[model samples]
Target: MYTFKFIPRENIAQIIPFLQILDVNIPAETLEQRLNEMFDNNYKCVGAYHEDRLIGVSGLWILTKYYIGRHIEPDNVIIHPDYRSRNVGDQMVDWIHAYGKANGCVASELNCYTGNTRGQKFWSSQGYEIKAFHYRKMLDNEL
Candidate 1:
């Protein structure tokens, strides 16, 4: 059996290695910036651990608009590769969804890369849909 907890910032260092294992693209500076912004914006971070070892991390942001009262985005969700296929990911998603709902979120949105078919399938299984296709372009430094 596994245990979970919402680790405080003082305990964040213990999870650095776990985050590295997940290979998430968030850089330290970016992470720090987001942490500060989230504090200012009232966003929150929740994590999961097993036997006192960090196993999963998720970042959530709440959005409010004139047309939409409140919405949420599961910006990042990562589980150690070794722990995949054991329903940890699904449980994480469910927890995030429930957290969002309880915090006044009317809906949640997430985007998975086209190449990540497994993730696409998982989200689909969780009842998310292909709302739209996103496009991005990188400009030359000279431009």
Candidate 2:
């Protein structure tokens, strides 16, 4: 069994390892910079812990968009290899969904990498449906 907690901004460093698990090309310093920006905008992270060890984490953002109204966005969700196949992701999503409803969110939106078929299936299992393709354009590139 595992327990869950809201990892605070001050402890954001604890999420670096998990984020690396999601994307190793990004440098730690880069991830830290982005985390700082996201946190400033009220980003929150829910972590799944097993005996005081963080085994999984998912970042959440609650915001309003004219298209979707108020919604929550899940970003770079990852479960440690040793912890996958267990319900760590589910628990984190469950906690986040409940949080969104409590905070007035009406929907959830996220961008999963097109090549991450496993991740896509997991999201679909959780009732997420593909609405549109995510497009991106890099401005400066270097982080």
lDDT (tens digit, per residue) of candidate 1 on 1-143: 56555656555554455545444565665555546656567656677767766778776778876655788887557788888899888888888888889989998887677787887888898888787887877685321
CA deviation > 4 Å runs, candidate 1? 12-40, 66-69, 136-143
Give the best candidate by TM-score: 2
Question: Model 2: runs farther than 4 Å from truth?
Answer: none
Clashing residue pairs in all predictions, respectively, total 0, 0
What's each prediction's TM-score? Answer: 0.74, 0.94
**Candidate 2 structure quality by residue, lDDT tens digits, 1-143:** 88878899999899999999877899999999999998998888888899999898989888899999999998889999998998888988888888899999999999999999999999999999999999878888673
- The worst-scoring run of ten residues by lDDT in candidate 1 lies at 14-23
Q: lDDT per prediction?
A: 0.71, 0.90
